[model samples]
Target: MKPLLLEIGTEELPVGALPGLAQALFDGVVDGLVKRGVAIERDDAKPLYSPRRLAVLLPGVAAEQPEQRSEVLGPYVNIALDAEGQPTRALQGFAAKAGVDWTRLERTTDNKGERFVHRAVTPGAATAALLPEVLAEAIAGMPIPKPMRWGTRDSGFARPVHWLVLLHGEDVVEAALFGVRSDRMSRGHRFMHEGPVWIAAPGDYVDALRAAHVLVDPDERRERIVREVREAARAVGGVARVDDGNLEQVNCLVEWPDAVTCSFDEEFLAVPAEALVATMETNQKFFPVLDEGGRLTPHFIGVANIESKDPAEIRKGYERVIRPRFADARFFFEEDLKQGLASMNEGLRTVTYQAKLGSVADKVARVAALAESIAPKVGVEPALARRAAELSKADLQSRLVNEFPELQGIAGRHYAAAAGEPAEIAAAIDEAWMPRFAADAIAPSPLGRTLTIAERLDTLAGGFRAGLKPTGNKDPFALRRNALALARTLVEAGIDLDLDAALEAAGADVAEVREFILDRLRHYYAEQGVPPQQFEAVAATHPQSPADFDRRLKAIAEFALLPEAEALAAANKRIRNILRKAEGAIPQRVDAALFAEDAERELAEAVDAAIADTDTALAQRDYVAVLGRLARLRPQVDAFFDQVMVNADDPAIRGNRLALLQRLADRLGSVAAIEHLSS
Candidate 1:
């Protein structure tokens, strides 16, 4: 085994593009090696990247490709031979092309009938001989959204390539990538290293780069940045708020990192903390410092590419660059306050939400009406819910929100509070967009939850009514996310609103929208480790209430663990198949006089007793108890299917047996269609 290394040195890459490029390079190289029959463990391939380079190191790679068996198909066997059973002209030509004697060719039979084939074992080639093609393939497959050409060269890449390194053990792999000749030399930090750093062997790459003042490994660079930022913040008597995004961007912006503490004017601290943090993190890529109470301090930490001799100068430069952005934020905040949230809402009338869905103000009106209707259902005051919904989109017209679109809801919360609105209303304005992303928290207040559901419903209704449902990856309206958020709020938050009725109230097709919501639930529960079949069982009944659907699913999951679950599920399936084939509709009422067989009589009795015992449990929505009670009838159910035949020659007997099975199936399916659980 030999260690393998490949590095592509380039001009500074976009910070946002570094991580994805590294992963894509690693995957492409690993796939290339595997496809060429070069043995290498997946875990043995390591990705190392900094702002100026992307590298993949393989610790244990085969020195040569494995010997392989080759086969080539020829003409059909019958056509390959003459009437006398001697080789024909076609067989002779095929054997010659395959470099084998006609007699050595074998006959094989497949779905398409007999065919003549050539088979042989061939020796493998050295891994070094295949490196040029493999390396080219890996580079050609990089995920460069926009490839650039440098000089007059035809080759295009994410960035202009300056150097290439391809080494196998102590030997340099002869190849040219991105119009640059592959060699053992790699460039380091442009300022720290004077020239190219020579790597003696594949294993010496990391140490050689480190000695040149470059942390080639992104993970190590990120850790260093984080530790330095925290220490810098500690020096100023505050804790550093190093968001993951800022840390990652900083990691990609520098090959050598040094965190410097800087501060702005104390008056700038009066700006909304979110606006300040956004400006610092987004525009400047700086980590803000916070007091013990989680309030933003004037001090912020900026990551520098070099360790300056006069650190005070670097600090001053950092503070100098951020002052204008802070002033802009402060001005935007004060100006927005003067307009007030209600006044800002007036500007929404001219903003279009969608071409066919009317203006933003129209959406607000619809959402407000829906919120008023759903408020009482979720135990919130109708007036409060309507007020929150009305002002939720007002932030879109704010200067801060226009500058930082991600702060839409956050800005509304701040503005509403400044206007002296009720705390619930202020919080609800922001919470209405709760679960802005998959991992975000749902609304905490009842009023917030109510408004969230109402807003999402209006969006869904308007989008679908405009014929803009999501198809493939083109969800311009984000219907999938809207549906999942609605379902999560209803089921996880314990809201008992009828999803179907809510859709109807919003002027959406109730049946179609209900299916859409349930489809999202199917995926939502599967992600939580629930089986698709478990969700389908409850979904088969098409429950209108998401809460009821959730309860039934919980019962089904627990019931599935019972030893009798398989037999019960299988029996339910059998009953359904029988009912489908019946001559006519099965009578709802089962007559005892028609129960001639003992198994049928016993099943009827068990059905009656189970239904009688489960009435209170079902009414209370005690699904677990209801399912457990139904499990007791599995023995009688099994016996009826085993001994009684539904298609008996006697018309009365067949009808009675069909009705009996129908009653049993209805009782079992009242909670869930257990038949879906069958294997």
Candidate 2:
């Protein structure tokens, strides 16, 4: 075995796409080696990358592929040899293709008859001889979103390629990519080192680059960035908010990273922290510093690509670059405060929400109506929820939000508070957009939860009405995300509002929208560790309320773990199938005098008792207790199916037996369609 290294040097690649591009490159090479029959230790392989380069290093790779062999089956003996026991035309042709005499070919026996076989073997070629093709194939498949060509090259890549490196076990493996030939030479940091660096072996790549002031490994670079930012924040007596996103982008933008503390006038702190943080992180990629209680501080950290001798100068440059953005934000804040949040709603009447859904004002009105209708049911003042909904989308017209689009809801919260609205209403205005992403938290306040459900209901209604439903990956309106959020808010908040009624009031097709929203739960519960069978079992009951669906799903999940669960589930399935195939109308009530078997009478008695025992629990949606009560009937159910002939010769007796099974099936499906769990 031998170690291998491959590097592709280029002009600065896209910072946001650097990590994915590097991963794709690493996977492509590994796949290529395996497809070519080259053995490798995947655990020992690493991908190293920076803005200027993408590299892959393998600590152990096969020196050569294993020996190649093949076998071909020829015509059967009866066809190969005629009645005279002589070679036929088919045998001669087979031997010619095998490059051997017909008599030398081996014979193998099968069920049909004897057949001739041709076996061939050849020695594997040297790994070095195949490296060029393997490396070229790997490079040709890189996922570059927008490939660019440099100077007169016919082909394009993510960036203009400047150099290539391919080394194996201290030897240069010859390969070429994008008008450049592979060699041991690699360029160092653009400013820190002026000359090319020499790589003697694949094992020495990291150390050699570190000496050249280039931290080639992305993980090491990211860790150093986090530590430096934290220490810098501590020096300023605050904690830096080093989010994964900003850290990753910063790591890609630098080869050697160093954090420097910078600050703005405390006056800029009066602006919304989210806006200021957006300006720093989103616009400039700086890490914001926060006080112990998580309030934003004036001090922030910027990671520089170089360790300058005059660190103060770098700090000054960083301060100067951020000053204008902060000042603009401060001005926008003051202007918006002067204008007040109420005035922001006037322009919304003219702004279109969607072509088919009317103006933004229309959406606000729909959301307001829905919120007011649902508030009292979920324990909130209708007027307060309606007021929050009215101001919910007003921030879309604010100057601060215009500059920072992600702060739509957050900007409204600040404006509402500044306008003398109640604290809960202000918080609700922002919380209305809770769980803005997959990993975000849902609304924690009653009024906020009301507004969230209302807004998502309105959005989903308009989206489905406009025919913008997601098909495969083409969700332009993000309706799938909105549906999942809607479901999550209802279930997580413990709100049991009727989903079908709400959708009907919002002018949506209740059945279609309900099914659409429930479908997203398939993925949601998969992440929650709930099996699909359990989820589908509850879904089959068509619980119109999301909270009820959640209740039944939990009950089914618990039921699946019981000792009698499997047999009960199987019995329910059998009963369902039996009832489904009845020749005549199955009677709803079973006559006591018609029971011909003791097993039938026992099952009937058990079914009635179980129903009476679980009646109150069923009405209250305490599905766990209801299912537990139903599980006890498993023994009677098993005995009845074993002893009774459901299709009896007497028509009256047959109808009664089917009726008994039908009664059991209905009760079994009361909590969930347990039959889904059978298989």
Against the reference, the lDDT scores of all candidates come to 0.90, 0.91
Model 2 Cα lDDT, one tens digit per residue, 1-679: 8888989999999998898888888988888888878888767566899999999999888888899888999999999999998889999999999999999999998999899999888887778888888877776888877799888988888999999999878889888788899999998999999899899998899999999999999989999999999999999899999888888889999999999999989988888899889988889999999999999998999999998999999999999999999999989989999988889988899999999999999999999999999999789999999999999999999998898889989999999999999999999999999989999999989999999999999989899999998899899988999999999999998898899999998989988998899888888999999998899899899886898899999999899999999999999998888888899798879999999999999999999999999999999888999999999998898898789899999999999999988888998999899999998
Candidate 1's residue-wise lDDT over 102-203, tens digit each?
988888999988999889888888888998888778878888989998899887999999899999888999988767899999997788789899999988
- State TM-scores per candidate: 0.96, 0.96
Backbone clashes for every candidate come to: 0, 0
* Candidate 1, superposed: residue stretches over 4 Å from native: 76-78, 83-86, 101-116
**Where is model 2 poorest over a 10-residue stretch in terms of lDDT?**
38-47
